[model samples]
Target chain A: MNPASPAIDTESVTALLERGRTLATPVLRAAVDRLAPPMDTVAAYHFGWIDAEGNPSSGDSGKAVRPALALLSAEAAGAAPEVGIPGAVAVELVHNFSLLHDDLMDGDEQRRHRDTVWKVHGPAQAILVGDALFALANEILLELGTVDAGRATRRLTLATRKLIDGQAQDISYEHRERVTVEECLEMEGNKTGALLACAVSIGAVLGGADDRTADTLEKYGYHLGLAFQAVDDVLGIWGDPDATGKRPWSDLRQRKKSLPVVAALAAGGPASERLAQILAADAQKSETEIADFTEEEFASRAALIEEAGGREWTSQEARRQHATAIAALDEIEMPEKVRAQLVALADFVVVRER
Target chain B: MNPASPAIDTESVTALLERGRTLATPVLRAAVDRLAPPMDTVAAYHFGWIDAEGNPSSGDSGKAVRPALALLSAEAAGAAPEVGIPGAVAVELVHNFSLLHDDLMDGDEQRRHRDTVWKVHGPAQAILVGDALFALANEILLELGTVDAGRATRRLTLATRKLIDGQAQDISYEHRERVTVEECLEMEGNKTGALLACAVSIGAVLGGADDRTADTLEKYGYHLGLAFQAVDDVLGIWGDPDATGKRPWSDLRQRKKSLPVVAALAAGGPASERLAQILAADAQKSETEIADFTEEEFASRAALIEEAGGREWTSQEARRQHATAIAALDEIEMPEKVRAQLVALADFVVVRER
Candidate 1:
């Protein structure tokens, strides 16, 4: 399961995630059965291996990207990969907790080609599922054995706080008419970066790396998250639907205060004005209209993004962040090959089309 | 602040609730500032001394029942009241977390005579506020000091799981058209009773009580919760609005599947059929013509309850639980008078009105 080769590719990441699932399955499955039968249905559905009737099925449940990040970071930090799986489980649970709630908040009825957790289970049970996951995450962390309990608790608790903080900012931005690029970055940093940072930080802690090494890996993970989000924002507007499987300019339609939009908005010209007009249009505009903005409109918005330095700026920022990540890994005095894997993973994040 | 006081003696309980607020304010206020500014706004509104705009005011926020239960149980357990105040705060936070999410799921737009947190801040922020409260509860429990940290964490974590389990059952019953009175009792026992039990358990833990004493106090809290909820059901069906501040039989109109309704449904007679008819009309009905049934209807339900021996059943159950609790305390070899005061408080739970 080499992270670099396609032979060691998404399937390898899936294998790592599956390893975590196996480790966590017994405790989590039993707890869900005892405490939340309905939510167990919702969670199983969310995992994409179950139908609406709560019966098992076969489907893809994404790459388990975040969990892989956690496990690899731990291994990169010199922790035993097998022992790192529990922390990966905790991170994955937190990720899913946010996703369940986020779907409800965003009014997203569908996810991964199936009805979202809330759309099927309703908001009440969805909320409970999120809560159950949160508790289970901590419960898993507590099983780290007392020797590592305090350190694991500290890292994971702080990560949980950051994830919550990120979500708060994300919701707040929806109502705001304006936002600075800096503010948008801060929001993205907390929302997406914190968890990724924690994935790596947990690795450092479990790998029994020094505090300095742990901190370095944390910075790397954080920057990687920010860069990943920036690229995602770019793809959200213009990526091929065949590849990304998202409606074109869906971010624009929702008036989402994304990074590229923030940059274009700050540029303040005809392009910005047009962008504002499109955003100000009732959000329920038809899909045809959303994807069919005039060529002039598209060109203006593109110019605005370029003029605001969105493309050049975010690209450089991504590279710089990646560099910082790599430098941090070097400072930790890790095995060069392991550090290379982390660095390669960081690059892969920004390079993804979807 | 005396738990032994009669229910009408709101003055003491109110004062105790205020004291719990006072003790919690410094720590919670600081944490809110640091971790979750957006959620803090909603939390302030939820606390009921604030307008939607987050302006402070003098509003009767809530009865603070859970915190009072925690503080009083701690006092009865022979701990210095001040020392256990943090435990009281943790329990109160858990209560509020549940309430914030509850209002959203129930579509309860108003609470404490003001717009609910979700109504004022929207569901997203409200959800985050609940999450923040959960995180803060864990952080506050850690303040019980390093020596006590392990016990505190375990107790709080278990308590949290039980809280979610209770909520899970509640949501499940809502969708499942038919549920027995026994099942309803079990649901409330988990959702509401678990917290009450934890309130006392946490108090005992913080109070440095022996395991036997803590276990006894926990049982006392559990029965007290059942008694409290049962009395509340009585008030919901037959009590005056002027006395209870809510319309009589509101639970019936809402198709609450409360203990009485479950009993009547199990009885399966004309009364049960009529009750079913009313519930079938609308699960959220609340008009007097619909909500409050005739004396015959009330009598029928009461007879069913009596026939099923619910009142006597629960009464004897409560007493048995309390006696077990008292025996556990006796094993601790505490002073007889202190034990008497706690026993009286447990009795008051069954008899309280308004």
Candidate 2:
């Protein structure tokens, strides 16, 4: 509502994220080193610190978005970025914890352009490592042993509960034939928004920001997370399989009720009707049949969804959320530098390619 | 190490456990009620508060032994049992969280005379709900907003980490052809001992006991956990399927590297050699072959383990650990009644039939 924005540059955002990874890595590694063998090895591999054979290597870990947000939020609260290291590492651990479990539960076999933890170590190991990381997140925060540390932990636990509840909703929605856009957004809020919101707020909490200030930061991050997921949903359907490193129409193949699919179905047009009919037929089939559906089957559904304006709707929604996230930054009194970094991240997350 | 023990009555121990459940159930339910939709239903079902059809039905939710220990530990610290409710619920939640995941990881279909959560709700819900419970446990402790709550939470996280580590070790041991008595016990200590240790001590910490008293109580609980698990291993191989609600020779069928199996292998006899050869051969088979193994195959291995003194060794080990646990109780100063109750629990855990 306030800004006539200049074009956001990408290099500054990349450098900020790189800075986050650099600062948080040593602490994160030291924590993982405390883990015993097998878990240590597996976690290292998942973080792209080692090759599959357990030798040192380098690969894509992630963009370090949450860590960057945490650090920036701390600075926003008038503390050094270093004050947010625990918050940064804690959120990163949680993000990966969810990923390990989510991959196994969703039956996806690859992540970060490599075989997933479950695919390589098996589902049991995936579950164990994920649980361990979640425990470690709380441990890191509480090890600080400050009143603020306990306050941040309470926020984290709440976010984690919401994150888990969202996963259940996501799974349940896959089986149901009908889902409204509102319901889909609510699920996304719980699934992705909660953690990102916590990422922004917990750092402030850790930096001794009062609840009101932290709450404002949380609002910014929540909208940013939705924007992030909206872009992901669009990419899941229309992005290049080679570039995205996923099967074509991956979400449709899995019958995932992502934003685009749900929005398309709710469009109430001829293409939407056909899409619903086909999805219903697919639902009635056995698990094997649904799993073995041809490439053409999913590709056709993607086309129908596009014809019903799902893709256009989702892209627009992402932009809207991105703008709302920026507006949220105005509600809090932050250094212009910190707000600029936050805005850069929001813009990058909404539009960045894989 | 301690005076000659008086005979402990089963009724008193049962009454203690029942009291623990009665005092902790409402708080546990209130915490669980905070979870959203399908998760709430799934968790309720897992706790035996509801039947498979979501109907209300009372069923076995396990012994509530940890809760009993927690409440009693608070009493030992000269606080009322109500002071331990948070510790009691937290440990119970962690206990059930492990069970839900372990049932899926170990592929066990039933527990406490009912189908396991994973078997009924699908593997995904099991993972998600288990995660929710773990988060909820931390939330319960931290919500008190007291320094003791933070202290208790730290202990709980450590126990939870060790618990996850134990699960990994347990899974890995099953794949190995040979496991020493020492290794098996180490794994059991991690898997079972850590949480029990936390349960007994966290309540005291919550009740404002000093570290020395909590440490002594922790030692007692650790031995008790090992004793409890030793009994469980014995039952897994030799107890009646009807009483235990498990398949015949359940541990052998699953090729579990339990104390009995390892002890028999370490016994170094003709039967032990045969058991090792059989297990090695079975390990080389495909997953389907292992899954389809006949009753006779498992029964034969059980017979070999028993003949090689595995079963007898485990039983004696249970008694030894139980005695050690009782001795540890003498290390701490407490009311005679609390010590007697602890003694009774130790006595019952070591020798009770399924």
How well is each residue in B1-354 modelled by candidate 1, as lDDT tens digits? 222333333444446667666766665556556656767767777777567766887776555566655666567667666666677777777788888888787666555556778887888877888888887777676644343454555566677787787777876687667897678778877776778888877866777666676666777677667767767776676656566656444555455666666766676666567666655554554554653567576555555555554455444554554445445555555556556555555555656666
TM-score of each model, paired residue for residue: 0.85, 0.94
Please tell me the interface RMSD, in Å, for model 2: 0.7
User: Candidate 2 on A132-235: residue-level lDDT in tens?
Assistant: 99999999999998989998999999999889988988898887889899999999999999999999998889999999999899999999999989988998
lDDT of 2 at B266: 96
Model 1: pairs clashing at backbone N, Cα or C within 3 Å:
A74-A203, B166-B191
Candidate of highest lDDT: 2
Model 2 DockQ class: medium
RMSD values, in order shown? 4.7, 2.5
Clash-forming residue pairs, model 2: none
TM-score for chain A in each prediction: 0.84, 0.96
